[model samples]
Target chain A: MRLNGNRSFSSFSFLALASLLALFLFFVTLLLSVFLYVGPRELASSLLSEEILFSIRLSLITATMATAACLLVAVPAAYALSRFNFRGKGLVDVLLYLPIGMPPVALGAALLIFFGTPMGGIFSARFVFEVPGIILAQFAVISALATKIMKSTFDGIDPEYESVARTLGCSRFQAFYKVALPLAKGGLITAVAISWIRALGEFGATVMLAGATRMKTETLPVAIFLNLETADVVKMSAAVLILAGVGLTALILIHKLGKRWPAV
Target chain B: MIRVENLSMRLGNFALTDVNLRVQRGEHSIILGPIGSGKTTLLKCIAGIYRPDSGRIEMDGEDVTELPPERRNIGYVPQDYRLFPHLTVSENISFGLRVRRSGNLEDRTRAMLDLVGLSDLSRQCIKCLSEGQKQLVALARALAIQPKVLLLDEPFTRLDSTAKVRLRRELRRIHEQTGVTIIHVTHDFEGSLNSRNRVAIMNDGRLVQDLSEIKKYLDEKLGYIPIDLRAGG
Candidate 1:
């Protein structure tokens, strides 16, 4: 009976391993399929086009800005969530989940509606259909993701280190920056890389708020959409490959850094 | 001098109830109790990490009930030692001094390293140290700040038998060398009890006995003398 049980377990393990390989192959094939539609020469020409170049620049700049803004707010917010218990903490947690749980299209529509409100109208000119709108949209979508990542990072760290620092003549801020922040280096890197990649790939919110204007507020994802609308599969494939390459590079870097500095 | 008067605190299901204790200057006092007896909580209250609901803590005869941990001038060494993983031994020892911007950084760090006999491991990473070595490094770090009182929670709990015996000796030497007031809490009666030290016994979040009262309490409760107490007696 025990030998039969062991044999069944072996079979189950093989099935699980086969499923993992199948999923891995599916993603690899899906990513590589873009190559079938566009030749290398055509891809190169499409990538070097003024519109594509503009979208690449715009995407990098806006994603960097959005990721920075997300981290600036997320780090402290995550620390508060991880460390302190305050009144309405449950409500605060639910509010943070709204962005992550809601569809990006709905969030974008909400922003569009808010921009039409009297109070939001004052700043609508600065954000709506503007370059800043792309940044704001990306930040709105990914800040919660950044916060969630950082909160888990801070959670893995013991609070006693900070307590010890506080008793060692460090003010609260000093303790956080000196001890807790250093320990959270790996998590912070993961948050930044993931948020930047997500912001780079953002489509629904950016298109809704910023409008897919050619060469004006065009990001990589937006450019891909516009290319596909005109049936320019070559240019769309080029954009897809670029996005995949950058995201892959970033993931590899994060993996390397994670090895070097494992989280506390 | 450190005094906790009428201290009471409730956290989750564990509560410290009306706990009162005092440790005079230049003395080492051990708060002995079993696990979950709220001994660490009481130490935390005195360290100002947790505010007691109804008590006032006094240091040097001044009330410090409202003071934050940073302002309390205490040294806290928790059970795990909590050495900063990214730091070296010297860096960990000098952390308090550097944060406070105290002068003579090198001199103070050197003194602390020498005091703990860890001068040779100054540049060693925290991960490389043994449990006993980490304990000494923690001791050095706490003493480097010249704190008004030192609070140690289960300092020897993680050590091997050999390291524990060695650490116990090192602790006594450190206490004598610095003359800093110390409140060391542990569950090991045999390892901690010393004739020269003041000992307090706690159960159910209350201080049930001190050195003078422990003999009678043990006689009535356990109906026998503990080996350590007999040795001390």
Candidate 2:
């Protein structure tokens, strides 16, 4: 009887621990959501601030460009990781992983220095301190994250599919473009959506590299920071509300697109 | 006819050295060996999946040692079946035909499915098939191309006794009906020796003996199974 009692107590204890952990996570998430809702926009006029409007526009445009460009670069990089064999292959894999762990500010600083240097001076002439600068900064941030995600997505696919395509008489590139790419559609869509959302929310990298100049380099996150400093709580809250709304919409779009992809 | 001359390869810890084999046209040849005997590697080399370090593979009097897998016109059924999991049974069967841009793909797919007795499961996903069903589907997929030489790597291991019997009968029937050359790799002596027209027993990556001396060789290496009279009657 004592032994049975002890066993019951242990099982109950385990269940209780699991319950508490889940409850803790649930409440934490619920609280953040409540803040996201109620902390922003008490009045109507605060929503029309010009800085808020400009930042919103810039954020959307830059994030879109960044996501598109990153995908262009990431697809080939992921394929190389998935299919190729060469010297320094392991080193390339390790290098790709480093960005996911490093601090975003450090990443921003590195980008700033690299781009600001003479070697960077050439490329920065095309991308820095302008509308293109914001896009470029966001591109750098998203590319780092996208490569990691895309690599895993491609790795999950079987090489046999490509081989089968080749045996069917497709060239190597044709096999990848037609067969491997089609099969990796789910992972690719998910990765792009995640990368887009991350680019949209990026503040640390954007602020350091792009420099939050209003009506130019100022993104939504930068606008929020600027308003918060002026203690204009109402305007700051309105901007936050709009940013959160957009982020939520993107998240919903991702879910919807995931469901509807492969229209065939 | 396919001929291999002094094939040698060094792959990590496992190796095949100075191997020679000759498979006649329209013959079912089984390569029997234990695990790690490099049967799969030999099949891969023949199918052009692996580059042998020093060897020549001649197919119909043409040297094809440097040919790529797709260019080899040989069919390979891997141990895992390696079916396209996302494709339906019909699609999987039609894959090679589609790749080859062959005519009447639908007809070929339907015929192969019928032969494998998988016509009922044609529209189902490859992942949803039973192990036996998967093996049949893989076989149908391989046959869709009507490959000149068929290479099967332990094709019967995943099957149950009933499925194994059915598949064996189907294989023998198919061989008879099509007259396609087959190179089967397996460790099962009963199936490899008793079922095949020619059998090669391998050890440590070498074809130690072909069927011409297999019975005598096996008796020397492994003693014969004892006959039981009292239990059977």
Winning candidate number (TM-score): 1
Interface RMSD of each candidate, angstroms, one decimal: 0.6, 3.6
DockQ of each: 0.90, 0.33
Q: RMSD per prediction, one decimal?
A: 2.8, 5.1
Chain A TM-score across all models, in listed order: 0.95, 0.82
lDDT of 1 by residue, B165-232 (tens): 88988988988899999999989877665436778888889897545478766666568777667665
Residue B47 of model 1 has an lDDT of 82
In TM-score terms, candidate 1 sits at 0.95
Please list the residue runs of candidate 2 whose C-alpha ends up more than 4 Å from where it truly belongs after superposition.
A1-50, A242-264, B210-217, B220-222, B225-233
RMSD of 2: 5.1
lDDT of 2 by residue, A1-264 (tens): 255346565776878778999999996685466456543445366667677778778888889989999999988998898788899999998887776787777777888889888898888766655668677777777786888877877887777667655554556787787678877777788778888888888887788777777777878888888877887766666667677777778789878877855321
- State model 1's lDDT: 0.91
Residue B172 lDDT in candidate 1: 85
Residue pairs with backbone atoms closer than 3 Å in model 1 (clashes): none
